[model samples]
Target: MSQRSFRRSIAIWLAALFAAYLALAYFAAPEFWTFRDRGFRTQHFEMVTHTPQGIPGDPINVGLVGTQKEVVHAFAVAGWDTADAVTLKTAIEIGESVLFDHPYPDAPVSRLLFDGRAQDLAFEKPVGAPAPRRDDGRVWETPCGGGGGRPRWGGSASFDRGVGLSHDTGAVTHHIGPDIDAERDFLMRDLATAGVLISTGDISGVGATSTGRNGGGDPYFTDGEAIVGILKQ
Candidate 1:
């Protein structure tokens, strides 16, 4: 081919490549492209460390302890919330353990909390007695009033959030106003709880649902699911 023709061909190819790149940027999800395309390198890690001061979005680097100790791991926060992120990171640092019905593993998503929140690590050991420690005045339950300094919301037997406040605190602080539309929502939430999946609301009513709840029904929105989670922090 002539020199002029060869140069022209190269220019055309470059233009086409640039156009394709721009198209991908405009149409594709940035996260899907960058994270998924790069692949999970953390699978090659030996030990992982996540700091508390950092929020979930922060990037956490883990190191490998195997034969390929030379390579470092790159992990983006796959947490649903900071709590879940912390739990997943902790799980990695402590190795692995089993709980409920699922096998918690050490993959990016497995250890990551998409909602940035994870199952509250209330007790280190799940299917047994809690860690042997003196009650350090920290109330294991919350929203339960008069016991220490918490305000007594009231006794809830069968709450949608699954909080059975046995304490006679008040007439039930679920006073979010009894709206007719809330029935189905509450019922669905309660059903989720019975199946072992605690919604954001369930986490907030943590005080009632622990050892003290499960005998009766307290009907009220109490706090919104999303709201309950945020307040716990």
Candidate 2:
């Protein structure tokens, strides 16, 4: 073959190889990693919490790494009030707060079960007038431990949009806003601002969905990523 023709052929081969590399690096490799990571998350994380009746409750979108005391202190530093347990006195107080538009900084939140047990801790922050609208989260100490043997707490953070009846049981409840991802970020920001977070990263949750329904049958959406924060010791 002529030298010029051989050079042209070599150039063509190299160009084709470069195109294949680009496809693998930009498209195929990323897709493979995504699938693999999703499977890993599914196997490792409890993606959602459940209602007492075994109905699926909120998707867990937050996590923390610390001891029980450290977790509580982090939230306290963030100005979040520890939620009162549901009791006769607290229930009556919430009822009056809803009816009379009174400010109950620490209010009782509905119970949600994770790993077949109720949350270990709950916290809330009043949004404004109209006592029902608030930011609340429930944390459960998972069996998993984080770096340095610290316990990991799985959490579901959501914004209560308004008071309403449960679509499943027709009982009174608070409807949550649809954008749960925003609520997750909101909580993370609060913790970071409180100077309690040492570092933050993400883990997989329920997976991205535009049409997710909680136990209350309220429509919600999320990016399906849970933010995991390592709290200061």
Candidate 3:
């Protein structure tokens, strides 16, 4: 081929590749593309949490549409124990659970802020009691106040497969698994099996094509469709 023709072909291919990239950037995850306009009430999703320093945390995967009492009852029926409030005794329990290889099913979770406060509710399902790692849990919060008789709560769920130091802060943090979507589904199934769910639905703008790191730099991913469920009293 002539030199001029070869260069022209290469240019065409590069243009095509660039166009494809642009298309993806525009049409892929709505959460990232339209991040600026996100509001908890209007948008389908929101950030999972924020760091103590106010950095963005994880992406919310699961949401609940019910009153506080209903939420507590649903999780109870699903065989999940409420996480103890963060206190000195609870802190010691978690430490012993890790060091002495004992089970603390109701271990207190580290604070993850939503609406400038820690989670309103937390629940956990122990895995192989006393095991060092691999436990399923969730942190839930009601970001918007219940007004006009509408009470809604939402948050993220993840499995702690291991525990390690944070890459960014060097503080100990839970190492969550990449397949966060599975954990979300697991919670739904548990609620359904217990006959506590009234209805289930999905909302958009939370899914992302690529995995993301949280404030602690733990990797996670989601379907972008927040699983929302209403519970019965």
Best by lDDT: 2
Tens digit per residue, CA lDDT, model 1, 1-233: 99999999999999998777555533343333344434333333211111111112111111011111111000111111111233546544423322233323221111211122221211111112211110100001222233234231111111122112212221111111222124324423332344322222322222211122111112222232211111110
Q: Clash totals for all models, in order?
A: 21, 0, 2
lDDT of 1 at 21: 58
Taking the tens digit of each residue's C-alpha lDDT, what string does model 2 give over 21-130?
Answer: 66764466545445543333233446887665555689999999999999999999999999987899998888898899988988889888776678999999999865
Report the C-alpha lDDT of model 3 over 1-55, residue by residue, as the tens digit: 9999999999999999877755553344323423542443332334556655444
* Superior by TM-score: candidate 1 or candidate 3: 3
* Candidate 1 structure lDDT: 0.23
Superposed by TM-score, candidate 2 places the C-alpha of residue 18 at a distance from the truth, in angstroms, of: 74
The alpha-carbon RMSD values of the candidates against the true structure, listed in the order shown, are 21.2, 21.3, 14.6
Put the candidates in lDDT order, highest first: 2, 3, 1
- Clashing residue pairs in candidate 2 are none
